[model samples]
Target: MVDGISFAIGRGEFCGILGPNGAGKTTTLKMLVGNAPPSAGKLWVMGFSIPAQARAMRRKIGIVPQSDNLDPDFSVVENLAVYGRYFGLSGREVRARIPELLKLAALEDKADARISQLSGGMKRRLSIVRALINRPELLILDEPTTGLDPQIRQNLWKLLRHLQKEGLTIILTTHYMDEAERLCQRIILMDHGRVLADQSPQALIRDSIESHVLEVHGSDLDHWVGEAPVPERIRCERIGESLFFYGERLDCLVASLDEWNGLNYAYRPANLEDVFLKLTGRELRDG
Candidate 1:
């Protein structure tokens, strides 16, 4: 269902695709992997057109989907062994690589354990290793850390960084702004199947909106908005009982709002989440 969305990932670059729910993040990933065909426009991965060169592309890419699709009937090691076989690796080669991959995923101790016996985090780490069995030049992950604990999430981040350092181009889709900020050098923000903005996290935050945001809470947001004098450098929005004012001229905005005694305020530097909410709007996108 993705439409009119376009972006490129450079060699060895970690590019993050970010958007809220139903923002076409998953659809974009599908199109890139040739699982879904684009109704319009072109998709080129590693300079090869998608769906047309899908077989060739698959050999160059490794995908770790959002869900754990590991075979529940097999042991952790068996799963990796089977995946390696699909990539045409010999049994001896697969055996030699199994222990190393397990160790890399921190699952060497659980190699013989059935997947059903392992925890969610273990399964996630195993899935990542399985995708890498064929030594892909490009790695694609769709919301790779969803449903994992914070510690496990951090572990996955470390592993991803290690892979990126080894010259792998990584493309990931996520709703976690912090993940995008921490891992990606370049990011694409999408909403309602359209590309909203694309740039590095720091550049997007700096250029799309203000550096700092003043969050104001009060009983009557409209009353405050009506009374507050409009400043040329700032943009304000009312979300429920709060007001978000974005601008570089924070001191002036604070001075102008000093007369409003009922509103409690806090000033903080803006991040990717702020840019997302502003570009996509505050309305609840239930879809």
Candidate 2:
């Protein structure tokens, strides 16, 4: 259902596609990998027309889907060996590359470990290296760190950064704003089957939203706002129990918080999440 979506990722670029649930992010990815053909419009990857040259195109690309589908019956080494054969690799070739791939994933010690013995993070890393069995020029990751803990996610980020530095073109789709901001050189923001914005996280924050944000939440927030109204220059929105204030400066707003007892507040620079909410709205979106 993606409509009017047009963009190109250059060689060795680390780009992120971000959106809420059911925002056509999955649909766009399906078309990119040739799993679902686009009904209209020209599509090409590395000079190969999509769906028409999909087979050849696929040979040059590696994909790490959102969910881990690693075979539980096989050990880490066995799993890699089996997947390598899918790319027409011989046993000897697969065996030769296993050490390097295992090293790349930081799982050299777990080479013979069963899939059931691995942690969620270990499985995710294995999934990544599994896709790299062919040493693809382009890597596509769909929500790579969705369920991992913060430390594990950071480790995955380090691996992805290393891959990019090694000259691999990577396309990552994620819902975590901070992940996209930190890892992606450029970000494509999509919603409701269409593209809303495309820019670097810094550019999106600087150009599309206020410079600063003040988040105030606590009891009797209404009474405080009634007693001392937000300055006209500052934009304000009340969502549930919190009041969000956006503007170039929130010094006055922060100072005002002291007068209200039991009110908690935080003042900080605007970020990718702010831009996303401002564009997509603050309301909850259900899948």
Candidate 3:
């Protein structure tokens, strides 16, 4: 259901498509991989037209879907063994790569364990490694670290960075602003099947939002708003009981609010979440 959604991913580039729930990120991904045909406009990947040359195009691509589609009947090693065979790999080749993939996913110890017995994080890691059995030139990951713990997520991040260094192009979708900032060189902000904005993470933060943000906490937000001196470049908003002041010069605003009690404050550089909320609005996207 996307319209005029066009963007390019360069070789060895790690691009993140970010949005709230039901923002068409998943739809866009399916169309790109030829799992769902676009209603209009041509979609291409690595110079090959999608949904038409899908069979040929699939050979050059690897996909890690949002859900873990592991076979419950099979063991961890069996899962990779069978998937590698689908790529036309020989028995010896599949065997040789299993250990490496298991090691990379940190599932070496669970090689003989059945899918039904593994933890959520272990299953997720195995799914990612399964997608790489063919050594695809372009990798597509849909919410790759959705249910992972911080330690496991960090491990995957390091592994992804290593793969990117090997000249593998990657495209992923995520809701985490910090993940997008840490992993993506360029990003597209999407909402309701449309692109809100697209730029490098740093550029998006600098250009879309103020350079500095001042956070204030108190019981009377409206009273504070009435007494607060407004600067030309500053924009203020309330989230719960806290007030956020967005402006280029946060220090000046901090000095102006010295007389306000219970207003503990701190200034921080702009982040992707600030730009995301500014462009897409602060409404809950439940779908």
Candidate 4:
């Protein structure tokens, strides 16, 4: 249902498609990868017309899906070997790439281990290397770090960054605003099958939200908000028990923070999450 949305991603650029669930982020990715056909529109990937030459385009692109779908019955090496075969890669070529991919994924030591024997992080790393068995020019990741812990997530981030430096064009789809901020050079913010904005993460935050935010916690947030100066310019809102005040200048807020002593409050710069909420609205969307 994406409509009136048009843009281009340069070679070697890392771009993210970000939005809440049902926003068509995954649908857009599916269209680019040839899994779904556009009812009507001009679209191309890697110089090949989409859905028509979709198979041809698939040959040059690699995809890592939301879930780790590695073959549980196969060992690490076996999994990669089978995936490489799907790309028409010869056994010799696949074999040659196995060691290199293993090193790239930092899974050299677990090459022969069975899928069930590996940890979650190891399995995720293997899935990524499996996607790379064909040596793709463009890589598409759908929530690559969906369920991992912080340490493993950071480790995977390092790998993706390293790959980007090696000249791989990456298209990432994630709702995690921080993930987009850290990995993408540009972001396409989507909502209800529409492209709301397309720009760098920093640029979106700068243009959409105030420079700083004051997070007020504890009781009677409504009273605190009522006691504030002008309501419109301050841009105050309440979520659960906390209150947030957004504005370009926080001098007044900071000075009042000393007087707001009994109430737990913190002031910080606005970030990508703020920009996302600002553009998409704060209402929760059902999955």
Backbone collision count in every prediction?
0, 0, 0, 0
Report the lDDT of model 3 for residue 234: 74
Residues 1-287, model 3: lDDT tens digits: 66678787788899999998988899999998899988788888888998999878887789998999999999999999999988888999999988889988888899999999998888888988899998899999999999778987888888889888988898999998999999999999998789988899999998898898888887655676677667675788988778888987777667767777756777899899889988888987777
Query: Each model's TM-score, in the order given?
Result: 0.90, 0.98, 0.94, 0.96
Please report the candidate that would top lDDT against the real structure: 2
TM-score of candidate 1 on Cα atoms, chains taken together: 0.90
> Local distance difference test, per candidate?
0.88, 0.92, 0.87, 0.88
> lDDT of candidate 4 vs native?
0.88
Q: List the residue pairs that clash in candidate 3.
A: none
Write out the backbone clash pairs for model 1.
none
Could you tell me the lDDT of residue 216 within candidate 2? 89
Q: Can you tell me which runs of candidate 4 are displaced by over 4 Å?
A: 229-232
lDDT of 4 by residue, 130-167 (tens): 88888899999998898899899898889999999999
lDDT of 1 by residue, 1-287 (tens): 67787677789999999998999999999999999988888889987899899878888789998898999999998999999998888999899989889988988789899998988888888999899888899999999998888999999999999999999999999988899999999989988899988899999999888898999897655677776665885777778878888887677667766777777888889998898888888888788
Error of 2 at 149 (Å): 0.9
- Alpha carbon deviation, residue 173, candidate 3 (Å): 0.1
- Candidate 4 local lDDT, residue 138: 98
